[model samples]
Target: MTIRFRPSEPTDAAALLRVWRRAVDGTHHFLSAQDRVAIDPLVADYVGSTALRIAEKDGEVVAFMGVTGQNVDSLFIDPAAHGSGIGRSLVDEVARPTTVEVNEQNEGAVAFYKRLGFEVTSRSETDEDGRPYPLLHMRRD
Candidate 1:
């Protein structure tokens, strides 16, 4: 599939949240079941407010990255499109050479970021919201 990216629009919020939830559910095995349940309803709100770039494949949003200045606040690929280069492409389109915080427990994501030339710059014992999930801060090399 030929993936392309465009700035997100107000109407894309719902679909973006769907893609985000799918990606999170598929990859966030470190999140407890209760965490998933608690987080689900917040997805739409977050997507609606973020400055995002949408990754489209065949005219459908297959992934998205939320960016602010040079920082990537969030990146999610539809579970159906995992391993299809969507995540990397979104990062390239929106936040290549940028900074990001990845969950340290998500080994695949850490490796993926490394493959894209991001190196660990620091780490935090809790997430931005003080969640228990540790975060690895990285910057492109």
Candidate 2:
């Protein structure tokens, strides 16, 4: 299991979207099946604060991560590739004092970030979406 990290390119957008939507669906457990669909592949580029990165194994993307300024826009791995250390690689490679807004409902990610030595300084809502997401702010130690 040799995982490789690369700066993401425009060509890898589709693969990144696949991983992102899966993570979104996992977050939106309450949404109806029909509403679970992602809006569009173009939405990611428009998300305003995303700087994309791709993780490949055997020359295929297995994970996607985006860093916007100091915030982690998202970190996603194929379900089959979970626990493969891809996420940790992303964090360590881009290592900086960072902040991320996790769906308050996604306890697993919250705990994982904490284990990595991130302390939540506050919680807040998502921008105008009224989704009540928590803004977890952390300074990497």
Candidate 3:
């Protein structure tokens, strides 16, 4: 499959949300039931507010990344498309990304970032909203 990247449009919101939900449901084993409920609305808000550059394959949005300043605010790939190098392309497209926050419980994601030369620079005991899920602050080195 050939994957391409493009700036997201307003009409892409619904597809982006679907990709987010599918990705989180498939990978977020660490989120509690309550945290899951709380994060959905947060995700919805993010979908509308962030400028996303999306990865499309076969004319369908399969992944996306949100960058704000030097931070990678979000990167979610369709669960079915995991291992396809789309995420790597998104990161590469950024001239130089210095920081990213990752859920500490997601081993695959932690390893993925590490493979791309990011190392944990700090840790948070809870997520941004004070949820119990821990986070690792990573920096490209």
Candidate 4:
């Protein structure tokens, strides 16, 4: 699989949205169907920012991410493409120290972040749906 990361352009919106929905489904936990209806617009808005990233595999977009708060906001990979290092590439490309929040229930993600050198700075609550989410701030370690 040929994987590459690039800044998002306005013309990339539709493909990016498809990647968002797929990346959400891969986890099969965070983004419920209702969550898409409610949160997609927020994703759309996040994409409008200058920090969005699109991950392409074999000439097709397989993942995407948004960086904010000096951290990665949304990082999603196609369910079929997990473990491909695309996610880590998104984080590796992070220009500064950053943080990522992993739902306490998502052990895999928590481990992934830890393996990638993110430390547990604190746990946080997510306002997106008013849930108590755990957060980890990751810097080069």
Candidate 5:
């Protein structure tokens, strides 16, 4: 399938949120149900307000990444589209972050970032929202 990359438009927020929910549900197994519920609104607000790079396949948004300066703040792909190199393409062509953070429990994500040249620099006992899940700070530079 051909993938198209572009900057996200205001109208893309809903699609991005759908991708986020699917991605998180598929990969974020360590999240508590309560935490997941609590974080949904936060994710919605962020998706609507942040600038993201989107990957579309067959005219459907299948992935998105948020980058700021040299940091990658978020990357989520539709669960149905995993293992398709969409995430890799987003990092290579759009995000290009020197730094990224991933949930420590998300082994797949850690491996994916490592394959892209990121190395763990530090760790946090809790996520940014003060959730119990730990986070690994990674950098490529």
Candidate 6:
């Protein structure tokens, strides 16, 4: 697949949100139904507000990531695009973040970050939104 990377535009919000939803559904089975419902609008808002790096394949958005300085705020790849290295490329080439947070229950995510040279530095009992899902704070070292 030929993947292109570019800065997100205002028109990309809907596609990015679609990628986010599909990715989360594919990987985040641990989330409670209620929590998922509550988080959807928040994610939609975040998609519109954050500046993102988008990965497009054949002119279709397949993944996107958000970064601020040395921190990776978000990364999501469409479920159909999983295992394609798109997420890895986004993290390594686009975000290149020194710090990231992963849901502790998402073992695949934790392992993915570890493979990218991140080590867990701490843990939190709740997510950034104070939800019950735990988070693993990681830093590249």
Among these predicted structures, which one has the highest lDDT? 5
TM-score of 6: 0.94
Candidate 5: tens digits of C-alpha lDDT, residues 15-107? 999999999999999999999999999989998998899999989999999998888889999989988999998887634448999999999
Consecutive 10-residue window with the lowest summed lDDT within model 1? 88-97
lDDT (10s digit) by residue, model 3, range 20-135 = 99999999988888878878887888887778999999899999999987788899999899998999989877667479999999988999999999999999998887878799
lDDT of 6 by residue, 34-110 (tens): 99899899989888888899999989999999988878889888989888888888888634448999999999899
Q: Is candidate 1 or candidate 6 better by lDDT?
A: 6
Query: How close to the true structure is residue 34 of candidate 3, measured as C-alpha lDDT?
Result: 84
lDDT of 2 by residue, 1-141 (tens): 678888777777777777767666665564445444434434566332355778898887888877867777778777667677888888876557777666555777778788777787767665225544445555565
lDDT of 2 at 116: 76
**What's the CA RMSD for each of the models?**
1.7, 3.0, 1.1, 2.6, 1.3, 1.4
Which parts of model 3 have CA positions greater than 4 angstroms off?
none
Clashes within 3 Å, all models in order: 0, 0, 0, 0, 0, 0
What ranking emerges by TM-score with the best candidate at the front? 5, 3, 6, 1, 4, 2
List of clashing residue pairs for candidate 5: none
**Each model's TM-score?**
0.90, 0.79, 0.95, 0.80, 0.95, 0.94
> Per-model C-alpha lDDT, please?
0.86, 0.68, 0.89, 0.72, 0.91, 0.89
Q: Please, what are the lDDT tens digits per residue for candidate 4 over residues 4-114?
A: 778888878777778777766656375456755877887776666555788888888888877776677777777788888888888887766777666665677778888
What is the lDDT for 69 in model 5? Answer: 84
Question: What tens digits encode model 1's per-residue C-alpha lDDT throughout 91-113?
Answer: 77654468999999999899999
Superposed by TM-score, candidate 4 places the C-alpha of residue 120 at a distance from the truth, in angstroms, of 1.3
**Where in model 5 is the C-alpha error above 4 Å?**
94-97
What C-alpha lDDT does candidate 3 achieve relative to the native structure? 0.89
**In terms of lDDT, which candidate is stronger, 2 or 5?**
5
